[model samples]
Target chain A: MDMIWQGIHDAFSLTIQRDPAIVKAAILTLQVSLSAVLLATAIGLPLGAIVGNKNFWGRNIIVIFFRTGMGIPTVFVGLICFAMFSRQGPLGQFQLLYSPQAIAIGEFLLALPIIFSMTQGAVSSLDRRVADTAQALGAGPIRKLVTLISEARIGVVLGIFTALARCLTELGIAVMVGGNIANRTRTLATATALETSRGEFARGIAMGIILLSMSLSFTLFLAILTRKKNSEVTR
Target chain B: MIDINQLHVSKAGKSICHVHRFHLDVGHRCWISGPNGSGKSTLLRVLANLEQPTSGSCRITAPAIDIVYLEQSPFLFKGGLRHNLSFGLKCRKVSRDVRLKRVEETIESFRLQSFLNQDLRTISGGECQRIALARALILEPQLLLLDEPFAELDLEYVELVNEIMSCRPTMTVLMTSPHRPPESWSFDHLTMAKHTP
Candidate 1:
């Protein structure tokens, strides 16, 4: 209890004082996680919409594959990225390992399936009449898809938030692929792990506090956005 | 113009609805009348190309973009009356000025001007029917398929809809109803009975 209180006090002080180490780690965390989430959303939303809205051979299999991927361990993602970015590997020529880019790549792998599966669920749960209505209104295939997605926008945004949360707090990928280099590749998650392992509880708690704050901020933003949309719909 | 030759629709190997030798000229209005479970809605859906016939053909002379279908309970997309009314025109990528002009005209014609700023969910069923009709008509579709357009409407609303529809002399309309339309409608009738086998 005493240690926790001390840590909380230290955290506020560090935050107010604008400690360079904590600030750098936080910025890097945001950079890597946001980039990963953006990439995941870009690829996942359309793919999920296609999978959810259309009937084709092996669609069920593809959905199950992505659903399974949502549960893949982050450490395993880190390992796979490590191999691809290591010397003598197929993609090793770019020399991306132990860098922020490598961490983002690992986080991207971690986030993609989550966004894809959630988006698929969202799109699939929509009323069947939505497509028919769009079609009846003379919308082409692409336009019809846009209409369906817009109707399901709330769910899509939720999927994006979930992916961002996952990417933001994950430690295995950040530690392994990012190498947690001070001021360069370190993220909140990696920094927290390092500080705690080194018996620096206050520092670890500070990083944890920042991480929690970020997640809370994102969730609040999502709530406000959805609330405004719902009010518009009902008002 | 529309033509159907021996149209049959089924579900789970059970015959639902079948029509033989039906034809309607461009700019004509037809009412499909039947009892409940007689597949009046299914036939309209088949004509709308929303459902495939089990073993027949429906040929519409209008281009796909010029054909529109409304279900029994018309769906209003999330938004106010104006958004729902102008959705079709937006889909067609009409200019904002043109869209606004057409939407305003539709609102006036449907007497939906008062409801334009209200939440769509608060509107009555008859009002929803009008909005759905207005949305479809804004596109000026050559072929309009309406499944029970008057199902939820009151007598006054029915007359209002009839009056509005009467103005579109060049648009083809095919609507389904559980009973014969009002004597004032002047629609050619096609009666459907439930398939026994």
Candidate 2:
């Protein structure tokens, strides 16, 4: 109990003093996670809309693939990314290993399936009349898709939030691909792990606090948005 | 104008509705009447091109943009009354001024001005149905398909719809209802018999 109190005290002090290492790690975490989430949303939203709205051949297979991907272990993704970015691997010519870009790439892969599956579920669950209504209103294919996406905007936003939460806190991909090089590639998650393993409880707790605060802010905002939406629906 | 020749719609090898040799010329109003599950709505869907007949053809001789279909329970887009009323015009890429002008005219025509600021969720069923009809009419569609447009309206709205529809003398309309329409409607009736075996 004494140690935990001391650690909490020191963590707050470190955060207040703006420790450069902690700041750097937090910034890198934000940069990498945000980049990963943006890329995932860009690709996932359209693919999800297509898969959810259309009934072409192999759509079920593709949906199944994405659903399976959502459950894939982050460590497994890290291992595959590590192999691919290693010097002797297929994509090694770019020499991206152990860099922030590598971390972003790994996180992007980790976040894609989550966003895709959630968006697909959101869009597929919409009333069947939405598509028919759009069609009946003379919307072309592109316009119809835009309409569907607009109607399912709440679900799409939730998917993005979920992806960002996952990417921000995931440790395996960040530690493995980012290599936790101080000031260069270290992120909050990796830095927390490293500090805790080195018996620096205060530093670990500080990074953990920052990560928790960020996630909590998002969750709070999501709660407010959903509450407002529900009220509007019931009004 | 619309034409249907031996149209058949089925689900899971069970025949639901069939229409044999039906034709409506331009500027004509037709009301389809039948018992429940008689495919009145299905036939309207075929005319709207929202569904494909299991076998046979349904041909509408109008620009696709000039066709509109309203479901039985009209779907109001998630927004204020004005947004739902102007949705179709926006789809056609009408200029903002023209769109606003048409929307205002529709609101006035449908007496929906009172509900302009109201949220779609808070509106009554009759108001929703009228707004949906106004939304469809704002496009000035050459061919309009309405599925049970009068299902949830009181006498006032029923007369309002009848009056508004009576004014569009040149527009082609195909509507479905389980019961006969008002005596003042002047619509040619097409009764769909229930499918057997």
Candidate 3:
């Protein structure tokens, strides 16, 4: 217990000192996680918006499928991505497995449902006339979509931060898909795992500190972003 | 002219509108009047093409396919008021300069210039209704559909609605009310019936 506290103090001092390796790892983690969250949001927000806003046959079925996917194990995603990106697989030509890109893809799949369902809730819960107003304005399809997205921006930002946190914290998919390659795909979560296994308590503690710091930053931003928006929405 | 034959609308196996036949010629200002549960709003929704008539067809000979729908509850976009007003312009492929001009005119018309830069979502209900009016007028829609447009307005503002409706010659107005028509306005009142399930 004493050693853990000492290691935590050292981690903070090292982080404040701008230690090159820790900073680099932090940047890499952000790069991979942000990319994944953005990609997922891009794909999921519109998919969820369309599904939730426009009614067509079988929409409920698709919603059920997505809702069911929300709780899938990260290791299962890693395994599926590995199969799809391996040399013997159909997408072998891409050679993405065991790379940062593969990890990003895995994270994207993991976060997709989070962003999608939130976007679905945002769109469907809104007054139906909002869409009608846009349509009656002769707003084209794209214009109407932009209007809807703008209206749901608060929910989207929340969904994005949620995706980012999930991506950064997930170790199973990153480890399997990225191989936790040093100086390549090593993120804070993966580095923590590797460092702890090698009995390097100090290094693992530093990485854990970075992970917690990232989460804190995310939550702070979410609070600032949603404070005013949420107050008005509630009113 | 707006024409409908065999128009039908239903929800949860309950029919809302079953207007067997109706037609509104040009220069006709029609007021949809009915008792509660008589499908006045549903009839307007079908006419506006916002919702499909479950089992019928409708056509319009109006000018340029332009329409404005004033929803009972104002729906404010999340951005500044200008974004809400100009959203439809982008869809019409109207140039930015033209859009800005119309926005300015509409803002002045509805006395919303004071709130132009305010975030739309934060405004009061009456203010939101004014924003909706700005959005509707900015597009120069030829047909105007109002679903209880005066619900959130101050009593003083209600009298001015007719004047606002008459400003543009090409604009045709349709308002649905559960009470008698406004004085000084001639309207063909219609009642909607639902088929018993």
Candidate 4:
């Protein structure tokens, strides 16, 4: 217990001092996660809307695939990206392996299913009158889609929030594809792992604290938003 | 003005409704009443273009006539009561001043001023229904299609709605009901088992 307190104390001190290495890793973590989450959202939201709003051939099969993808292991995704981007692999001429782009790609893959599945669930559960009302009010197709999406805005935001959480916290993809290089690809997750392995407890704990606090803040925000939404819906 | 010719609708290969011939002049009111599952809503849906006819066609004489359909259970989207009230007007791109003025008038007329800023989900079922009607009326629809608009409403509201319908002399109204409306309002009767003009 004394050791834990000491570590926590030292962690805050290092974090407040803005230690160069820790800052670098923290920035890289945000950059990579933001990039990946943005890409995932850009791809996931439209696909979700399509699946949620329309009936087409093999839609159930596609939904099944996405639902299954949501449970896919991060390390598996990292492994797949590594294999695709490795020097000996086909289409490896771009040599993206072990780069920030590679890390972002892996993270994007990990977050996509989460965003897609949640968005699909949200849009699918919208009230039937969302479409009917929009149509009766003289809304064109694009306007109707906008209205429907706006009505389901809470669920969509939750989906994006879940994707951000997944991208920011997952270590398997970041470490495996980012290569954990000293200054270049060292995200917070990778840095924490390396520092802990080297017995640099203070630095590791500091990074962990940051990650934990960010995650907690996000969950609290979601809780508040969800509560407000429920009250509004139930009222 | 509207015209129908041998319109038919089906669900899962089962015939739902078949309307042989029907016509309505501008400013006319038609009341459709029938037993449950008699496709009264189906015929209204066909006229509202909410449902596709399995065969035949419905023709609107006015090329640019606006239409609004109100469902049995009033639907208020997730928003403030004012937002729900102004939704149809917003869709028509009504100006901000007009929207505000119209919303204000509607609130006063329907005695919904207290619910102006309240969340729609917080309102009673009857209140929501009134809001739905107010929203539709704000658009000044040339054609109004209502599905059992009086199901859960109070007598005061029922009379209020009838008064509004009567006041709109040029707006054609087609409504579905389980029974004929009160004796005060006169409407052309179109029964579904056999659509008699």
DockQ of each: 0.61, 0.49, 0.42, 0.43
- Candidate 3 matches the true fold with a TM-score of 0.87
Candidate 4 CAPRI grade: acceptable
lDDT of 3 by residue, A1-235 (tens): 9989887887778778877777777888899889989889889988888887898999889888878777888899889998899899888899998788899899999999988888887888777776887777776666667667767777877777877888898988988878988788888888888878888777789889889988998898778867765444332
Query: Which residue pairs does candidate 3 place in steric collision?
Result: none
Quote the lDDT for A205 in model 4. 97
User: Which residue runs does candidate 1 get wrong by more than 4 Å?
Assistant: none
Considering lDDT, which of the candidate structures 1 and 4 is the better prediction for this target? 1
Judged by DockQ, which candidate is best?
A: 1
Worst 10 residues of 4 chain B by lDDT: B188-197
**Candidate 3 error regions (>4 Å):** A222-235, B63-65, B113-128, B151-155, B186-197
What DockQ results for candidate 4?
0.43
Worst 10 residues of 4 chain A by lDDT: A226-235
lDDT of 1: 0.87
Interface RMSD of each: 2.1, 3.5, 5.1, 3.7
Chain B structural similarity (TM-score) per candidate: 0.93, 0.95, 0.88, 0.93
lDDT of 4 by residue, B95-146 (tens): 9999999988888887887775566666777878888888888787889999
- DockQ (0 to 1) for model 2: 0.49
lDDT per residue (tens digit) for residues A80-104 in model 1:
9988998977889999989999999
The first chain of model 1 has a TM-score of 0.97
